[model samples]
Target chain A: MIEAIRECLGQEMDADSRVVVIGEDVGVLGGVFRATDGLQARFGKERVVDMPLAEGVIVGSGIGLAMSGLRPVIELQFLGFGHQAFHQIGQQVARLRYRSQGRHALPLVIRSPFGGGVRTPELHSDAFEAFYTHTPGLKVVAPATAYDAKGLLAAAMESDDPVLYLEPLKGYRLTKDEVPDERYTVPLGKLRVARAGTAVTLIAWSAAVNVAERAAEELSEQGISVEVLDLRSLNPLDIDGIAESVSKTGRVAILHEAPLTGGFGGELVATIQQECFYSLEAPIIRISAPDTPYPLGGVEDLYIPDVDRVVDEVAALAKASA
Target chain B: MSESRFLPNFESIAPFSRLTESGILDSGESPMSDEAVLEALRYMTLTRVFDDKATSMQRQGRFGTFSSVRGQEASVVGAASALDPAKDWIVPQYREFPALIRHGYPIENFALYFMGNPKGGTIPANVNMLPMQISLAAQIPQATGLAWGLKMQGSDGVAITFFGDGASSEGDFHESLNLAGIVKAPVIFFLQNNGWAISTPRENQTAARSFAERAIGYGVEGVIVDGNDLLAVHEVTARAVAKARAGDGPTLIESVTYRTGAHNTADDPTRYIDQQELEKWQQKDPVERIKNYLRSRGIWNETLEQEMLDSCAAQIDEAMEIARNTPLATSDALFDHVYAEPPQRMLDQKLDWANRNGGAR
Candidate 1:
């Protein structure tokens, strides 16, 4: 996964001189997870610049650079750290295009690692994709695999809108794919069916996608057909794909590591209920962590939804329907 | 913490002046030519006239609350005139109408902005200026990033951002200064220490002796100048612009000036400022001092003043007339410009709003 990101960045920077990478420790240290490893030596210090430990400046400056007709890919280290920069991200970066009546294009790409299960310290893991999804002018996208990561990065660069690209920390090293070396772009705002089935559909994104896939495999062993859909893009969500999947199955479960109260899962459930309400055979279940701050490493396992939790809930729905 | 161990007395970049308070030419070694001085005098007078007109218009219930750039004309005109507008950019933090005007942003747009129109904030494509930033200190970091891009693009362009004394306390200010120092970004941190950030006085804004002194901690050059002294402001700004273009790194310029009016039209200065202090600043009026200097040079008189004021007043009157004639903003304008392409949800909301507004859905 790290190699995939580095290759995409290299290709994009090689292809266009306008593309530059600026973030904390991205240049000399090759980023926290080495996602940008070797980019500095490959792209030079000027193109791959390391910034001070200031998140607002990182995002705000990215806005400035983008306004100056340069593409700045600002890395926020982690999603939780993005709080320090939420003002810039939510205010100037997102609102400039609209407020200026389309006179300026803040083509700033903000990429941050999110989701829990990595035993990270305080405020290191977060899944606040909804905060960005609710924003009007910005584009929000989350990729669950290396293939998607590379493609989306390429697509984000080619486009002119500001994209808040969320990368899962667990996927950085754990998730891998036979990603093609050459550059390719997977169009944004689309969902992928990771595992197809006919009985029930499990909708998930980021790390939740893997958990849903594992749950689907486990449920299949017990003769329960479960379809797993990867909701890669959260902002411009593919509501149609979700409606079709739920109509085929009649039951659905929305999953995310974020809290249950107002996560992206809630929006997906609402959309599904609205479009596929007649096809529903049972109430749509939303599985998520309790509405509480992410616990320390000692109790993280209890907070994150696992394969068993998903299977237990899915199996019960199937049993209730039968 | 030893004051003199690491450094000597913080050399005051003494404010340069060629004219006295009453307008006598105290120093003859002026940087500007005779014609340039006349031009500067004209701009300062026009800015003051526009400021008074805006305040009066607001009080007459024709527009919203407006920030008047009264005594800071020299700082505004000087900093703007020093830059190459075609290559340089101005990140305005509001209250820079004079600078924006010098950058080719029409004064009528500013007048329209106060009249509650979004199009009033639109700077033309030829003008290198951003929209008025009401959120304090946000433009600091943005300017740093802009300079970084300019350097990367191999352009000699520099980025200058204007802010108030109240903004110096914002975290964005320190963060941006540190980043600009580290990257040696070709940016200028222009602070118009206009005595007050609304009701909060400059003395309460920071513990540092001066806003310029705060720059030293960020590892950037700190220089102070008389914001009311036009030549001093222009000389320092021109030097900083050239230094940035030469890639010597960023400089923090503290334009020591005063906001001679209420913070905004909604404000009443009597609530916070002493009448005596207000009277003291009036003596240092930017336009009158420059006019006096030009008068001592046998170049300014009542006839010259009347002609310039008449022309400027007529121009402003025409702009106000145009604004009064323009139709009110459409409700649909709210939905437009939120994104390059409006999404399905926004489109639906726009339709609903239009229908509810006038059955235009």
Candidate 2:
């Protein structure tokens, strides 16, 4: 996934003279994760510039650059660090184009790695999609696979509206897939049914999709076929996709790496219930992190929801209804 | 021998004033032609008239809360005079009526904003002026970025952002200055030191004697000009813009001025300011000083003053009429601009509001 991000950024910068990369250590250092590696040397310092350690200025510069007919792909270092620049991203960048009544076209992509399970420092692995998803006029995309990573990054670069592109910290190098060399784009506001099933459906995105797929495999051994739904985009959430899956399977479980209370799962659960109230056989279940700050790096494996947690919860829902 | 007579040997800055308050010009070649002086003074007077009328309209509940540019006319106008609208960009804070008008923004745009219309921000493309930002110093970074973009495009254009004494205390100001310095961004940080952030005094904003002195630590040059002196403000800004376009990096300009009115319609300055201080600023009013200067040059008289006042009154009335004739916005107007394509949740909210409002939305 990390390679996919770097290669696509290279391709996009090569393709468009307007595409410029800006962030902390993005120039010579190529970012902490090397997501923008080797572009500065090829594109020159002005196009792939290293910014001062100021998140507000980074995002704020993105807005001005976008306004001046440039497509800026800004890296925020980490999702949790984005809170420091929330006013720029949330207030101005998200609302400027809309408030200008379509006069300002802000083609800015704010890319940040999110989620836990990798032993990283505090504030480096928080899943903060809910905050961006809740903002109007901003699109949020979370990719769970390398194929989607390259495709979504390309799509975000090509998008007219500002996109909050959230990459997974755990899946950056751990998760691998055969991404095409040629540029391709996956449309936003759509979901993919990774695997089809009959009894129950498990919904997740980003790194949590791994847990859902694994849990479905475990449940299949017991003859309880579980459908897996990957919500590729959070803002224009594919409501019809979730509704169709939930109606087919009578039960569901929502999973995410963010905290339990006020997490995105709550909105998904409510949405599914509203769409398929009569199809529900038992109370829906949610597998997520505890409502607490991200724990120490050593306890990350235990902190984030795992396959065991997903399998246990779905099995309990199945037994409860039967 | 015990107490040697010592005169102040430090180079004291005689505040750069080309036009004296008593209708006299100090010995030097004038920076402006007679027509330019008249044009500047007219712009200042028209801005003052607009502000006064806006205040009255707000008092009568015809407009939303309004901030008056009562005493900071020369600071805005003179800085605006330094820029060519074709090359330089103006990123302004909220109280920039004269600058916006000088940059080709219609006066009715401000009236539209005061009347609570979002269309007020939609300035024409050729003007090269950004919309007025209400968040203290947030536009500073954007200005730097725009300047950087211009430099990247190999254009000899500069971007200038306006803020006040209070905004100098914000983190945005410091961060923007730092970035502008590091990248050698072709930008100018124009600080209108109006002595108050609502009620906070300039002395309380910083302990560093003057705001311009901080430029040393930020790796940028800075200048201090008499904000009420139009010639001084225009000259200093022109120099700064020249250096920025020449690739000498950013500049911090501290324009010392005063705010003579209440912060906004919602607050009264009498509760927080000393009456004697208000009297002192009123004496140095930028418009009166320029009018005196023009009068000293044999270009201003009773007939011109009368004609100018009458023309300004009619222009303001026309602008207000435009704002007044604009129909009130409905709840659907809120949903219309939220996104290019309304998300499902936004659509649902709009539908729900329409249902509750008897299809009014």
Candidate 3:
């Protein structure tokens, strides 16, 4: 996924001179994750800038750049660090176009990696997509596959509105697939059905999709057929797509790495029930982490919902409905 | 260990000025032409009239809550008058109607904005200015980015942003200055030290002697000017704009002034204000000082003052009438401008809202 992102950024910058990348260590350092590797050398220091270690300025200045006819892609080192810049991202970037009444178009992308798997420090693996998804003007997208990462990033850069592109930290190097050499865009606000079944449906996004796919395979071996839906876009949620799947399966389990209370899973549950109320044969289950801060590395595996948890929860829902 | 010994020695920055409180030309010859002075006087007078009308309208339930730019008219108008609207951009805070008016934003838009219309923020394409930022110091880095973007596009236009003393404490201010200094961005940080941030005084806002001195830490040129003196504010701003256009990097100009009125219609200055200080600042009223200077030059008289007052009053009355007659934004308008293309969910929600409200799609 990292290599795919780097390639997509190179292609976008090559196609548009107005496309600029600004962040901390995005220039000579090639970014902490190397997602912007060799960009500064190929595009020069002017296009790929290394901003100071200030998150507020990074996004705030990007707003100004976008206003001046430049498409700015901001690379936040981690999603946790974005709290320092929520004022810029939520208040300014998301509201500029709406506040200006279409006078100013802020075509900018704020990219960040999140979710726990690797033994990162505290606050490094936090998943806070719910906050951005709640913002009205922003389009929140979390790509669960390499092909989707590149394609969705291309689509995000081309978008006239602000996009929050969240890359799963666990999938950056672990998630792999065959990506086309030429450029291709995956349209946002759509869900991809990773697996097909009939008895139960598993709704997930980002790194949670991997867990759902694995759980589906295990469930199939047990004769409890499962359907896995990878929600690529969270804000402009594919409600119609979700409703179609839920009506087909009649049983559902929403999963995420965020805390249980007030997580995006709650919103999904509410939406699903409203859309698929008569079709639902069993109650929708939410498989999520506890409502606690992201703990230290040693016990994080216990904190994140694994495949067993998804399999167990879905199997119970399937049996109860049957 | 003595903490005093560890403290670094710093040179004190003196406030730059060209006009005295009595409107005397103190610093050699004036850089302003006779026509320019009259124009500045006219805008300053108009700002005062607008402020007074807005406050009155708010009290009479004819307008929404508004911030009064009563005593700091010279600081807002003088700095804005220095820009070439064709190329330069103005990024202003909320209390800058005078500057926005000088920069070609229609006076009626101000009425519409305070009346809670989103169309009020819709600046004309020809006007190189951002909408009024209500958030403190949030526009500083954006202004720097604008200047940086201009430089990258090979345009020589400079970007100037207005902020208050309270905003000087925000992290965006420090980060923007540090970034603009290193990149040599063509921008100006116009800090209006208007003595109070609601109830907090300037002394409590910062422990440093002057806000301008902090510029040294960022490796940028910093200067202070008597914000009440229109000549001083204009000279300093023009010089900074020239330097920025010449690729010399950003400058931080701290314009020292006072907000003699309440912070806004919701505020009552009588609660926390000192009578002695208010009386002293009233003596240095910017509009009165400029009028005195114009009168001393035989360029202003009773007839000219009456004409300016009548013209300003008529303009305000017409703008308010138009604002009152302008139709309120429809429910569908809320769903627009969020994105280039509305999503299916949004379209569905819009349809649902229209169905419930019995309105057209």
Candidate 4:
């Protein structure tokens, strides 16, 4: 997925002089995660900027470049590290267009690896999509597959508003699929129905999307039909898609790796209740990590909402619906 | 009119002034043209009128709270007038009522923003001013970067950022200066030393006896001026801006003045400092001094004075009417512009809210 993103950026930069990538350890060092490897050598140091150790500066500079007709894709090493730059992201980049009444549009893509699975340590694997979700002027996108990543990233880079592109850590290296090196943009407000079923619907995104997929496959073996929906975009949710799936399934198990309280699941549950109320045979269920600061990666196995937990929730929903 | 002096150094780091308190031109000075004087007076008057209108509207619950620039107009207008509006950029702190106006922010913008409308100062791209930075001195680095960008693009433009004396204590102030020096960005760091940072006086803010001297540490030219005297400010700023546009690095100008009113209407200055100092600073009021000078020159007559006051008051009244009639911000608006396409969570929240409330009421 990271390679696909790198290819997308390289292709995009090749066509436009206005596009630039900036972040800590993005130059010569490539990136700590090597997400931006080989690009520095391809595009000189000026365009592939190696920013100072100030995330706020990185976000702020991205805003400036975007405003002056430049498409700046910023790399925040980890989602947890974004707290330092939240002001620029939340206040300046996100709010610039709305606050300016469309006079200024910050076309910036902030890419950061998120979620927990592999043992990376504290502050390195937090699933903080909700923090940006709460902010008014940011589009949050979490892609599970390489195809969605390249397509959505291409879209995010070109969008008129600021985008918070969360690259889940578990999927960065582990998830690989054939991603075509072409200029294509997947619309930001669409959801991908990864698997189809009728009895129950499992909705998730990022690494949790994979968990939901595995859970659906396992549930199918148990003679229970399950639908797994990958929410490509977190902000402009595909209401029609969610409504159609939930109405067909008659039950739901919303899953995410983010902490349970006030996470994206709470919104999904309410959305399903409102839109597919008459079709629902059972209450909507949410399977998520416990409501606590995401634990260290060493203990994160206990924190991430895994395949078995998702399967169990879907099974419970299927039984209840029956 | 000899090309204004560049990086002039005096033995002391105190206030620099070419004009006296009486408005008498010192030696080596020729009287300004009638048109230039009127232009200066017009920009300053507009600033004063704008500030008065904004503060009054905020008090009346029209706009959000504002940082008042009542006594600091000279520093704002003086430096703003020094720049070529087409080729220079102005990065303002919140209290730049006059500077924004000078840089072509429509009078209606004040009403739009101060009247609690989201449209308040929705800055246009063609306009060289940035939306006022509410955080103290945060715009300094941005101005530096902007100047660097302009330099790289080979545009003959200089960027000037305005902040209060207290802002000089912030680390961002130092970092921006260092970067500008290293890159040789054509920028100016203008500080309005209003003697207090929301009740914390200059004495408590920094130990560097003079904020202007801080420029020396960063390898940029620094000058201190009597912020009350508009002429001294204009002359010094004109010189600094010229050097900057000429590819010389940035300059720092500290305008030593006092904030006569509370920091905001919420503040009570009477509780903190000496009433005597306030009264003394009031005697050196920039507007009063300029008006006195104009009256003495016979350029401002009783009729013109009365007409100007009436016109300013009438304008404020009309602005108030517009603000009063403006509708409040809506809820879907919260979901509207965060991004070009809001994520699923945001869409869901808005839809759920619409379902509960029967549409964003």
Candidate 5:
């Protein structure tokens, strides 16, 4: 996924002179994750510039660059670190176009990696997509696969509105898939059906998609065919796709690594009930981490919802509906 | 009690000034031409007139809550006049109607903004200015970025951002200055030390002797100007703009001024401000000081003042009429401009909203 992201960035920078990459350690250092490796050398220091450690300035300055006819792709290092820049991301970046009544086209992308199971430090693996998804005028996308990562990033850079492109931290090196060499975009606000089934549906995104796919395989052995839907975008949610899947299966389990209270899962559950109320044969179950801060590495496995948790919940939903 | 070793001795920096409080030239000849000074006086008068009318309209329920540019006209107009609207850009805080007007923003648009119309926020394509940023110090880094972009485009234009003494305390201010200093962005950090941020005084805002001195820590040139003296403000800003355009990097200009009026229409200055202090600031009113200077030079008189007042009132009336007659945006307008292409869910929600509100408008 990291190489794919770097390739897509190079392709875009090659295509557009206005596409500038700015972040802490993005220039000579090639970024902490090497997602921007060789960009500064190829594109020159002016295009791929290293920024100060301040997160607020990174995103805030990007807003100005975008306003001045430059497509700025800012890296926030980690999603947890974005809290320092929430004012810029949420208040200024999200509302600039709306507040300006569309006169200002902020063609900007804020990329960050998040989610647990990588044994990272505290605040390094939190899934805080809900904070951005709740902000109006922002398109929130979380790509679960390497192909989607490159495609979604391309689409985000091409977008006139600001986009929050969240990459799953664990999937950066672990997840692998065949991504096309040539440039292509996976349109945002759509869900990818990772697996097909009939008895039950599993809704997930980012790293959770891996867990959902694995759980589907386990459920299939027990004769409970499971459908796994990977929501690529969160803000402009794939509501139509979700409704279609829920109506087909009649049983659903929404999963995420974020805490239970006020997590994006609650929004998905509400949306499902609203759109597929009559089709639902059983109550929608929400599988999530507890309503506590992301703990240290020792208990992170217990904190994150694993394949066992998803499989158990899907099997219960299938049996209850049957 | 002994002084802590951490406390270091600092030198007191004097604010740059060209005119006395009595409107007499205190330094060398003014840098402004007679024609330019007259133009500045006209814009300052117009700003005062517009501000008064907007405040009155707000009280009469005709306009939205407004922040008046009452005593900060010289600081606002002086710095704004230094920019070339064709190339330079102004990223303004809320209290910059005078500057926006000087930069060629229409009076009708300003009136529309005070009337709570979103269209007012949209600047014409030709005008190189961002919308008024209500968030404190948020536009500082944006100004730096805009300046950097201009430099990258090989343009000689500079970007100037405005903020208050209160905003000087925000993290964005420090972060933006540090970044601009490192990159040598062609930008100007215009800080208006207006003595108060609502109820908090300038003393509470910072322990430093002057906000300008903070620039030394960022490796950026810093200057302090007597904001009430239009000549000093204009001279200091012009020098900074020239330096920025010449690729000498960013400059932090701390314009020392005061906000003699309420912070906004909803605020009551009587609550926290001392009457004696307000009275003293009133003596150094920027509008009166400029008017006095113009009169001393035989460029201004009672007849000229009446004509200016009449012209300003006529313009204000016309703009207010246009703003009053402008139709409000429809329900679907809310769904528009969020993205280049509205998502299916947004479209559905818009349809639902229209249906709920008795069909489309």
Candidate 6:
């Protein structure tokens, strides 16, 4: 995924000189996530700038740069630190296109590591995609593997809207797969299925995709058929894929780490119930974080929906059908 | 022509002064256009009447709690009128009724906001203004960014942002100023120093003598002006806005005004502030000073003043009726604009909620 992001940056800068990058340690240290590693040496500091340790300044400047006919890709060092610049992201960048009567384009992308399981300290492991998704005129995407990361990064850069490109820290280096080095763009709303199954559909995105696949394997051993669907995009969600999967399986389980009350899970469950109301053998279930602030330390695992939770739901569904 | 006949260069005027309290434009300044002076007074009166009526409605439970721009109308209207309306943009904090109204926002829009509708107060897409923001200092960087966008579009338009004295304490304000200066973006930071932010006094807000001085550190010119003097405020703002539109970079304007009312109907200034301060400011009310000046110029009369008051009251009454008659926002709009194409999740939630709540069926 890191290599894919770097490759996209290289391709985008090569195509458009107006595409510049700015973030902390992005130039010399190659970013704390290594997504911009070596872009500074290749694109030069003028293009791949290393800004101060101020999130507000970084995002505020991106707005200025984007307004100046330049496409600036910004990296927030961590998803938690983005709280510092929520005003710029939520109030300014998100509304610039609509507020200006489509005369202005905030052609900017904010990329950062999000979600838990890396054992980072307080504020470092946050699932903030839901927050960005809640905002208008902003696109939020979380790629679980290399292909979506690279394709989505290219897609985000070429677009004229602001995008929150969330890189799941747990899936960043641990899960690597083949990705085309050439320039290829993935449409914002398209979803890709990581693995296919027939009995019950397992819907997930970002780090949850990995857990879904693991649950699919465990459910297969228990003579339970499970289909794993990876939701590559969040904001412009691939509803077609969701409907198609639910139509075949007749059962759905939505998964996410954010608290369940206003989580994307509720929305997904609602969508399945609406689209395939007659096809259901059981009510659609959601395996999500309990409605609480994400707990830390020994309780972090409990805060996130895992493979065991996914398997348990699958078992109950399979038994009900039998 | 005597030296007094020449327009007084705002560059020489004291930032906060009371020369205009006697109800006369100094004879030294160039004779101003009679029409321009009347227009300024007209808008100022309208703003004052509108504020009073809106508050009364809130008290009567006709509208929700509202932020009143009572004493600071002259500063807001003067500065807004000074700009080229077609080319400039406005980013307003909650308490900018005078500026918003002058820029073509109807009083019904305030009703829309108070009625809990997002689309209610939404500035028309074609208008050069943004919706009023309630979050402290959140709109500063946005104005800076919008101005920068305007510069990139090759238009020499400037964007002005309004905030209260308390908002100056937010980090976004400082960050926005630094970026605007560094990029030389055409934007103006208009700070209304209205003495108190709810219960907190100006002395406790910041140690910096004047908020405008902070711009100096950002490599831009900063000025302090008596916000109550409509002519002085207009002249100072006109010059600063011209400089910005000409690509001379941003300016920080500190308008030293007094809030004659509570921050809103929700607040009670009598609790923390001295009653003496309120009485003292009544001696220098912005609208009364302008009216006194116009009467002295022989352009205004007792009969004309009474007629204008009656007309202003009638206009407010009409606006109140329109605001009250406006329909409440429907719940469907909440799901409608979240995205150009909402995800299935949104559609599902809308359907589920609708089916259960009876909106879907």
Writing each residue's lDDT as its tens digit, candidate 1 over A68-160 gives 889989899999999999888888898988666677888778989998998999889878888998887898988999999999989877777
Rate residue A168 of model 4 by lDDT: 78
Q: Single out the weakest 10-residue window by summed lDDT for candidate 3 chain B.
A: B1-10
Global fold similarity of model 3 (TM-score): 0.98
- Each candidate's root-mean-square deviation in Å? 2.1, 3.2, 1.7, 5.3, 2.0, 6.9
Model 5 chain B is weakest, by summed lDDT over 10 consecutive residues, at B1-10
What DockQ does each listed candidate score? 0.73, 0.55, 0.79, 0.30, 0.75, 0.25
Deviation in Å, model 5, residue B3 alpha carbon? 17
Question: DockQ score for model 1, please?
Answer: 0.73
Fnat for every candidate: 0.72, 0.48, 0.72, 0.34, 0.69, 0.28
Model 2, span A177-217: residue lDDT tens: 99999989988888989889998889999988888999999
Per-residue lDDT for A1-322 in model 6, tens only? 7888888898999999888888889988898878888888998877887765678878976876675568889999898999999888887788756443344567899999888988788778868777887787798888889888999999888877788999988988888999987899888887788788888888888998999999999999998888888888888878788889889989888888778788888878876787788888887788888887756757898788888888998789866752
How much DockQ does model 4 earn? 0.30
Q: Candidate 3 chain A: worst 10 consecutive residues by lDDT?
A: A313-322
For A232-264, candidate 4 gives per-residue lDDT tens digits of 998777889999998887888888888888988
**What's the distance in Å from true for residue A159, model 4?**
0.7
The CA-based lDDT of model 1 is what?
0.86
Query: Which residue segments of model 2 deviate by more than 4 Å?
Result: B1-15, B351-361
B202-230: candidate 6 lDDT, tens digit per residue: 99888776788778777888889888888
Error of 1 at A10 (Å): 1.0
Q: What is the docking quality class of candidate 1? A: medium
| Model 2: lDDT of residue B200 | 91
Worst 10 residues of 5 chain A by lDDT: A313-322
What value does DockQ give for candidate 5?
0.75
**TM-score of chain A, cand. 1:** 0.98
